[model samples]
Target: MILSLLGRLGRLWIVPVALAVWELAAREARAVYFPPPSGIALHVYELWFSGPPARLFLTDDAVAHILPSLGRLLLGWSAACLLGVVAGVALGRSARLSQYLSPLIHFARSLPPPVLLPVFLVLVGVGTPLQLAGIVFGVVWPVLINSIDGARYIDRQYLDTAQVFGLSRRERLTRVILPAAAPKIFAGLRLSVALALIMMIISELLGSTEGVGYRLLIAQSQLDILTMWAATLLLGVLGILFNAAFLAVERRVLGWHRAAL
Candidate 1:
């Protein structure tokens, strides 16, 4: 039991050790741009998380900015994934459709989504719609390509077996194709989460008010170095949490797949 506990603690020791090193280096350097993690943490707390206990200690700014940003991120990623999966599945199942559309997909994906921010702005105007479109455009390609690949490369044996069983089209898809393609689909989804966060920030960078990205832009404009670093730290932590959550879900959903392998 002690050994197991030690093993768990051992894995996490590097985090504290790294922070200690950073703290010492930043103190020694006395750089305005590079504040210690402790200070950054406190600053972020004071800025966003210092509300009444009833509200889970989240300040107004936290509610105003963080929530909207999170909402946008979730909505955008979800929309993109849903669209990608549906379209990808249809295209994968249809050779002619894929043949006609593959070139267009590649060309559209080749154009940087950030560059098209202006186009989106012109089309959709500013605010949530614009941000959502940007994120969808940027992150959808991975999911689409992976979904298509997953659907296209499914084993013939599985299809034959399904046909023998007389499974309906929906049943074949839900039971066979999706299960087989889940790993690739999940890979794309995981990658898109990171891209979603990036695009979330990028979308907010050039546009209107509110969001974590806007906070960063504000800090930079005001030369609030500490706030900037704190915001950065918060973003890093959020990224870690997002990735961790995705991994947990993937492990749970694909546990059988892993065991089979």
Candidate 2:
């Protein structure tokens, strides 16, 4: 029991240790660019959470930046999830279709999303639509590919058993295929979520008037390194929180799979 506790505490020690090293280095160097983590934390709090908790801890400026970015992120990510799952399942179940579509899929996925920013700007103009389009295009591929692989490789016995049990097509899909492929699907989802955040920032950085990304860009332009660092930190925290929340959901949904394994 003591050893287990020690191991858990030891794992958490790295964070504080790293922060101590960073603070020492930043103070010693007296570099304007490398603000200490403590200063960044304060900047983040002042910029975003200076308001009362009753008001959601967001000032108007924070709201303007955060909500729009989150909106784009959520819309794009949700669309990708829905489309990827549907398309992946369809292609996975049909080997012939997968073969026929392979080349097109490869071509589409190979196009780096950032490189298409100019085209999207022209196609959709500089607005939420452009940002959203870029995000969907970039983030969908991982989930789609993983879903395809997962569904394609489902054990033959499972499918055969579903058939033997006289399950309907929908029943077989929900009861057998989705559950079997869920682990991989969730894995892809995690990747897609991260990609969604990246694309969101890139899209905002290239164009548009609002969002955390835009704020980050403006801070950099103004040489407010602390604010830039704060935004970067905020982004990192958002990613961590998103992943952790998704993991909790995944554990709940796939509890049976864990038992089976």
Candidate 3:
């Protein structure tokens, strides 16, 4: 127990040590653009415990900004996951359909979503839909491609066995194919989550009334370095939280695969 506790403590110490080094470096360089760790921490505390009026969290405004970004991320990512998995599964199950759609899928995936933000803005206007579209467009390809690859890689012997049992297509897919392809689907989801978060921030940065990115922009305009650092720290925390939550869900869902890993 003592050794385990010490090990954990040692691991946790790395972050502070790195931050200290960064703080010293920033101080030495006298770089106004790069705030030291202590300065950023002070900003983080202020944002978390007290903020000026008109921000989301009057007491803890960080939560307000964080929640909106998270909401956008979840909405867009959830839609992508649903559509990507369904389409990928169908395409994987049907070689003819896959061939027919391959060119179009490739073309769409090849295009950068950032470049199309203006087009989306024109079509959908600067609203939730446009933001969601950007997030979905940025993230959907990974899920779709990974799902298709997962489905296609299922063993031929398993298919033969299912055929011999006279299982219906739906039964075969639900009982066998989906279970086998779950890992790949999860991988896609993990990748998409990160991408979705990035897109959410990008969308907000482009034109948003509220959100961490918008707050960061505001801080920049006002030359409020502390607030800017606070926003950045909030973003970093959000990213860590998002990743941790996804990892927890993945572990819960794929517990059986742990042994394989």
Best by TM-score: 1
User: Per-residue error at 27 for model 2, in Å?
Assistant: 1.7
Candidate 1 or 3, higher TM-score?
1
For model 2, name the residue pairs that clash: none
Query: lDDT rank, highest first?
Result: 2, 1, 3
lDDT of 1 by residue, 62-120 (tens): 99888999999999999999999989888888888999999999998788778888998
Stronger candidate by lDDT (1 vs 2): 2
The runs of at least 3 residues in candidate 3 whose Cα sits more than 4 Å from the true structure, single-residue gaps closed, are: 27-30, 49-60, 164-168
**lDDT winner:** 2
Estimate TM-scores for all models: 0.96, 0.93, 0.88
- Per-residue lDDT tens digits for candidate 3, residues 70-174, read 788888899999999998988887789898988998888888768878888888887678888999999999899888888888988988999999999899999
Off by over 4 Å in 2: 1-7
What does the lDDT come to for candidate 1? 0.91
